[model samples]
Target: MAGGGVAGHGASAGETKLPPLTPGPYRRRLGFVALVATFGGLLFGYDTSVINGAGGFMARPDQLDLSPLGLGVAASALVYAAVIGAFTGGRISDAWGRKRTIAVLAVMFIIGVAVVSIAPSLAVVVVGRVVLGLAVGAAAVVVPVFLAELAPYEIRGSLAGRNEMMIVTGQLVAIIMNAIIGNVWGDQYPWVWRIMFALAAIPAILLLLGVSRMPESPRWLADKGRDDEALEILESMRPPGRAKPELDDIIHTREIEKQRVSEDIGKIFHNKNLVRIILVGCGIGFFQQTTGINSILYYGSDVLEEAGFGTGGALIANIAPAAISVITALIALQMMDRVSRRKTFLVGYALVAFSHVLIGTADVVLPDGGAAKPYVLLILIVFFVGSMQLFLNIATWVTLSEIFPQKIRAFGMGLAVAVLWMTNGFLTLFFPTIIAAIGISGSFFAFAALNVIAFFFFLKNVPETKGHTLEELEEHVTDGSIFHSIGRK
Candidate 1:
C-alpha cells in the first residue's frame, strides 16, 4: 500500500505514528464528482423542506381541508415510505451496484415530484410523497457511502460531508422559493403549493443526466473481483503513482474477509465486532432525531405559529434556521478535517441541550401574545438549529458511512438509517399532537433532557474515523480496538 504522511518531529521518540495523508492530487475531479452525486442530497433536502412551507397551504379549506390527524398523516407519508426505501435501497445497491441504483433513484425522484405537483386530491399527493420518499431514503443511504469510498482518507470527512451540506442547501432553496411563491401568488391562486413541489424536478433531471457520466465506486469494483477495472478507476482519481498499491491493498483485504465470513446481512449479528458497529450506527441515528431537530425542520412554521407568529410572519421567520443551517454546514465542512469527531459531537450536544432548556424556560416565563415572546422564541430556535448544524447533522452522516466494513456496508447502513427514518416518521406523525398536548415549553424541555442522555452515549461508544482511509479504518473496527479511542489507529 502507498505510505501515509510522516509523523511530526514534535512527537515523542517512543511513540509510533504513521504520517497523515495530504489531500492534493485529483482535487478538481473529485470535487466535480462529489458535486454531481450530492444532487441526490439536494433533492433530498428540497423534497423534505418543501413540506415545511407547503403543508399549511395544502391543509387550507380551499385545498385539502385536512384535519390535524389528516395533516399528520399527509406530512408523515413520505417519511414512512422512506423507512422501506432505506432498507430496500441498501440491498439494491449491493446487488445492482451503486451508480446504476442512484440513476434509478433519480428517475424515481422526477416521477414522484411530478405526481405531487399535479395531484387533484390529498390521496394522490400522499401517493406521490410515498414515491418521493423512496428516492430520498435511497439517496440518504447511498450518496454518503459512494462519496466515502471515492474520497481519499485525508479529505474523506469533507467530501462525504458534502451530501449533508447539499441537503441543507436544498432546504434553504425550498424555504426561499416558498416565500417567493407565497408572496407572488397569495390566496388568489390555489395552485401555488403545486409550484413549490414541481420546482424539485429540475434538479432531479440534472442528477439523472450527470450521474450517467460519472465513474462507479472503485471499492465496489474491487470487491466484485474486477481488480483491473477498479485499478483503472482508482488511477484516474488517486494521486500519481498510488493506484496500484491501493488496488493491491483492497484486493488483499477482500481476500482476508472472504476467508472469515460469508457476505450476509444475518452475519452482522453473529459477530461481536460487527454487532458493536451496527449498534453505534443505530445509536447515533436515533439520538440525532430524538434531539427534536426535525421537529423544527419538518414543522418549524408550526412551532413559530404556536409561539405566536401569524402564518405569514412564521413563514418568513422560518427561513432564518434554514439560512443558519447552510452557513453552519459549510463551517462544519471546513472544520471537519481539523477537529476530532467526538469533540465536535460533544460540543454540539451541550449547545443543543442548553438551547432546549432556555427555549422551554422562556416559553414558560414570557407572557403569550406579547410582541417580545415570538421573537425571543425564534432567536432560541435559531441557536438550537445552528448548534445542530455545526456539529451533529453532517458529523453523524459521515461517521455512519465510515464505521461499517465494506462487506456489510450497504446492509448495515441500511439497517441504521431504517431506524433513523422510522424514528423521524414517528415524530413527524405526532409532533402537532405533541405540541397541542404539551405546548412548545414542555416539548423542548423533553428534547433537552434527551440530548443530555445523547451526550453520554456518544462519549462512551462512538469511534474516531477522521484521518484514515476506509480500508485502514476497517482493520481497527473488525478487531474491536477502535471503540472509545481518540483519533488513534
Candidate 2:
C-alpha cells in the first residue's frame, strides 16, 4: 500500500519486501543519541558516590559548620527528589515525546550539578542534591525504555545493556577521580569535590544535543496513530531497501495497538498476572537496594575503616568493591545474552546471601584485633559485590524491562524502579542507624536474610526472558510462563 513505489525502483514486482533496510547513517545517529542519554547513568553514579571524598569537608562541624542531622539531610534529599521525578517522568515523556523529555532532564542535571558545586550551606547542598536526584531518577527509568524500544529486539539486551555498563563505568570513573583528587589535591583545593559535582554538566550538555536529532520510537509513533510517520521512522531504522518488511512489522504491531490499552496503566492494573510481575519487579528492585549495596557505594571507605583499616587504607579498600563490580560486570555482559534471566537472579541472590553469612560469621568469630580478620572480611565483600554485579545489578533491570505487556511497559517498569530508588533512599538514610544499632555483623546478617527471601521469590516466580523478541515476549509472558520457563515453540 506504499504510494511512491513504482514496483521497479530496485525491488521486485511482487516482492512484498520492505525496501532493503540497507545499513546507513541512521544507526550512527541512534547510537549517538543513546550514548548521550546514557550520561544520565554517568551523572547518577557520580552524584551518589563522588561525595565519598566530600564527606570529611561536609562533616567538619567545627570548620565547615554542620551538624550530623544537616549532613544526613543533605545526603538523602536527592532520593526524595528522585521518587518524585520517577513518578512523573513517564507522563511527561508520553506527552512531550522522548527527546524533549531527555533534553529537560539534561537541563536539570546541569542546573543541579552547578547548584551542588556552589552550595555553602547544608541546606543549599540538600536542595541541589534533590534537584540532581530528580534528574537521576527520571534518566534512570526513561533512558533504558527509550533505548529498548528503539533497538531491534534482536540486540535489545546488548543495546539496553549499554546503559547499565555505562553506569558502572561512570561509577568507576568517579571513584578513580575521587581517589586521584583526594590523594594529591583534595586536601589542598578542598573544593575539588565541588568541581567534580559541577563537571557533570559536560555530559548533560552533550546528551541534550545527542538525543535531539534521533527519531522517535516507531512503536510510539504508531501508538499515536501516526502510521505514515511510524513507517518513515521504521524505514530509517533499516536500509532504505528493506522498508517494506520493516514497515510491515511496525504496521502489524500498530494494527494490534487497540487490543493493548491506550491507557497502559489501567490495563496493567486489571491483569492479575501483570500485577504479580510488577510486584516481582518492585520486590527485586527494593531487595536490590536493601542489600546494602548503596551503603558500600555511598560509604565504602567509611565501612572499610570501621573494619579497622587506617585512614588511607579506607580509600584503597573502598575501590575494591567498585573494582570487583566492574570485573564481574564485564563477565556478566558476556553471560547476559547467554543465560536465563531467572537463573541469573537466583544465582545472584544465593551468592550475596552466602557472602553475608560469611561476613557475619567473621565478625562474630574473629577477635577484635585478630590480624587475619579484616583481610578475610574484605575478600568476602569483594565476593559480595561480584555476586551483585553478576546477577542482581544487570539482571534485575533486564527482567523488569521484559515482564510487562507492551501497553503498560513504561508504567510497570517505572513504578518498579521507583520502588527501587525509594528503598534505596530509605536505606541510604538509615544505614548509619542500622549500623549503630545492630553492629556490622548484624547488618550483614540482615542482608543475608533478605537475600534468602529473594532467592525463594525468584526461584518460584522469576521468568526468564533471555533472547526473546518483544513481540514474542508479549505473547509468551501472558500465558503464565516466566521468561526462563518459556519453551522455544
Candidate 3:
C-alpha cells in the first residue's frame, strides 16, 4: 500500500487525518476531465511525430525543396517554437486559468495544422510549424498540471500520467497512419505528407469542444482567491466527506503562496530553496531529452534504412517501437500510483543505458553483410523505447506537474519544460547529422554514457513523490526538506 506523512503544515494528529477515497461517480467525472485535457498531449505527439514519416518526402525537390540544413530547420522548427511556448505557457495559465489556456491552444492547433498542410514553400511550412510548436509547448506544461489539480492525491500519479500516455498514443497513431499512407500511396509524394499533417485537426476540434464544458481547476481557482467557486467544483469532484478538508489544505497552501506573491518573480531567484528546486526541475527535463528517445522517434525510419531496410520496410518496422510505446505506456499508468517515482527513474535510466550498450555492441559485432543485423537492431531499439515509456516519460511529466510549491509551480514547470524542449530541439536539429558523422554504434554508446550520469542525478536529487498530497509536497519543497534526501519520509 502507498504511505506518506500527514497533510498540512504543523497540524495536530486529529487535523492530519486523510480524506475518504472519492466515490465512483466523482471518480468517473475526474476520469472524463483527464480524458478531455489530454487531447493537447495527443496533438503534441502527432504534430511532432508526423514529420518523422513525412520528412523524407518533404526533402524531395517537388515538395518544400529542402536542402539538408533546410530539412533540419523544418524538423526542429516546432521544437524550438515549443521552447518559447513552454516558457510562456506556465505564466499564461497561471494568469488566464488552465481550461481557458487549453481552449486557446486547441484553436492554435487547428490553425497550425492547416497552415502546415497547405504551405506553398519551405518558409510557409516553417511558419506553420512554429505556430504548432507554441501550442505543443504550452500544452506540455498546462495539461499535466490541470489533471494533477483535479485528481485526488490517492490517484494523482495515474491521472496526470495519462497525458504522457496520450502523447505516446498520438505518436503510435501517427506512425500507423504514416505507414498505411506511405505504402499505399508511395507515388503521391508530398500529398501524402500533407494528408498526414492535416489529420491532427480532428483531435484539436474535439479538445476545444470537450474542454469548453469542463470545470476550471479547483486548485487554480483557489489560488486565484475564488474559494467558494473552488469549493463548488471540488464538492462535485470529491466525495461528500472529503471535500471540505481537502479545500482546507488547498486554502492553507494558498495562504502561504500569497505571502510570496508580493515578491513576484523575484522570489524564484532570491529564495535559495526555490532556486534549488527550479534547478532540479530543469535538470530532470534536460536529462529526459538526453536519453535520445526523441532522436529515435524523430528519425527511426532513417536509422532503420541505414541498417539495411528498404524505405517501405523501414516505415513498417518503425511501427513496432511505437506500438510498444503505447503498450508500455498503458502498463506505466498502472504502476505510476503504486511505485516510488525515484525508484522508477533510477531503474529506467539503468535499463535505458543497458539497452544502448547492447545496441552499440550489436552494431560492432554483427557481420557487415549478414541478414541478422537489421533485425537485431530493431529488437534492441524496441526494448529501449519500451523501457522509456514504461518508466521515465510518465514519471518525468507527473513529477514536473506536482513538484513545485503553488507560488512558483507554473513558472517553475514552464522553465523546466522549456529547457526540455530546447534540448529536444537541439537534438532534433543535429541528430541526423550526428548519425551521419558517427554510425549507430557511436551514437548509442554516447547515449549510454549520458544515461549513467542521469541515473546518479536521480539517485542524489529526486525525492519520492508517491503518497503525498500536492499540499504536503509543497510544504516539503518550501522548507527544503524534499531536497535533503532522495527517499525522504
Query: Best candidate, TM-score-wise?
Result: 3
CA error at residue 139 for candidate 2, angstroms: 0.8
Clashes found in each candidate (C-alpha, N, C closer than 3 A): 2, 19, 0
Clashes of 2: 19
**TM accuracy, model 2:** 0.89
Give the lDDT ranking, best first.
3, 1, 2
Tens digits of lDDT, candidate 3, 251-335: 8767766775443887568777788888999999999999999998989999998887889999999999999999999999999
Which stretches of model 2 miss by more than 4 angstroms?
A: 1-30, 239-247, 260-267, 478-489
Winner on lDDT between 1 and 2 is 1
The parts of candidate 1 lying over 4 Å away from their true place are 1-25, 484-489
Q: All models: lDDT?
A: 0.87, 0.72, 0.90
Give lDDT tens digits, candidate 1, residues 1-489.
Answer: 112222133332113323333465578889889999999999999998898888888888888887888888877999989888998898889888899999999999999998999988889999999999998998999999999988777788999999999999999999888877886685788668999999999999999999977889999999898888898888888877667756656666677678765787676678898898889999998999998988899899899999999988888999999999999999999988889898999999999999999999999999999999999999999999999999999999999999988898998888889899999999999999999999999999999999999999988888887776676667667877677374442
Q: Worst ten-residue run, lDDT, model 2?
A: 1-10
TM-score of each: 0.95, 0.89, 0.97
Give the higher-lDDT candidate: 2 or 3.
3
